[model samples]
Target: MQTHYEQEERFRLAKKRVDELKGFYGNLVSYIVVNLGLMILNLMTSPEHLWFFWPMFGWGVGVLFHAMKVYGFTPFFGKDWEERKIRQFMEEEKKRNESFKGE
Candidate 1:
């Protein structure tokens, strides 16, 4: 039911999605490993001061956003929202073009 181009396009989109997932997972793993190391170092050097949580919290926030974006947890700016906006813009453009052609 689909053309070669359509199949290829679907494959490309799927591959891109997989790549995004891989990137998010890689970022998460790095965050965990680095934060764990920092926590241990902080505990070993300055257990009283306790500064590891700062970096951990900041990086954790970044990772959370990354995961949200990759997982499409963004309610307002998700794929559906984007597609709708794109269609809206295209309709507006088409109307404008038709008006110009009529003139």
Candidate 2:
């Protein structure tokens, strides 16, 4: 059973995660709305240059990164890395304990 503090910490973490998800969703909605407006403005004014793609690309990159962060999809130092580190340390500790027993 978790202590009261542990439960509170878990709740806090959950709330933080929820907030991150909410923020990402908000960003996505804004990106869509703003880009649509930009596209319309571009089409109405300068159909030849098509400068709308620039902001779309830049903000697309931002949205991608925001999604990655909110979803914890890091290419490096993610859950896989954490699990590998835990296993490595556990193995090392087991070896040390065995050596101690031999001594």
Candidate 3:
């Protein structure tokens, strides 16, 4: 059985994950909305030059990476790595606190 502190840590991690997902979704919505508006404006102004693709391509790459992070699609430095780092730091902090208490 997990302790109360461990449960709290799990809740915190879950909250952080939810927040990251929310931010990524918001980014995706903004990307789609703004890009569509830009495309429409481009079509209205200059249908021959086709300049909207530049910003769309660049911002689309950023959105793709953000989605990868939120969805855990990458092989390196993924959620497991993040959880391990968090636990490692928490252990270090507990040790530091114990040492301070002893002093």
Backbone N/Cα/C clashes per model: 0, 0, 0
The C-alpha TM-scores of every prediction are: 0.83, 0.73, 0.73
lDDT of 2 by residue, 11-44 (tens): 9999999999999999999999999999999999
lDDT per prediction?
A: 0.96, 0.96, 0.95
Worst 10 residues of 3 by lDDT: 71-80
**Which lDDT tens digits does candidate 3 get at residues 1-103?**
9999999999999999999999998999999999999999999999998999999999999999998988889778887889999999999999999999999
Please state the error at residue 35 of candidate 2 in Å. Answer: 0.5
lDDT computed for candidate 2? 0.96
Error of 3 at 2 (Å): 2.8
- State model 1's lDDT: 0.96
lDDT of 3: 0.95
Per-residue CA lDDT of candidate 1, range 31-72, in tens?
Answer: 999999999999999999999999999999999999999988
RMSD for all candidates, in order, please: 1.9, 4.6, 5.3
**On a 0 to 1 TM-score scale, where does candidate 1 land against the true structure?**
0.83
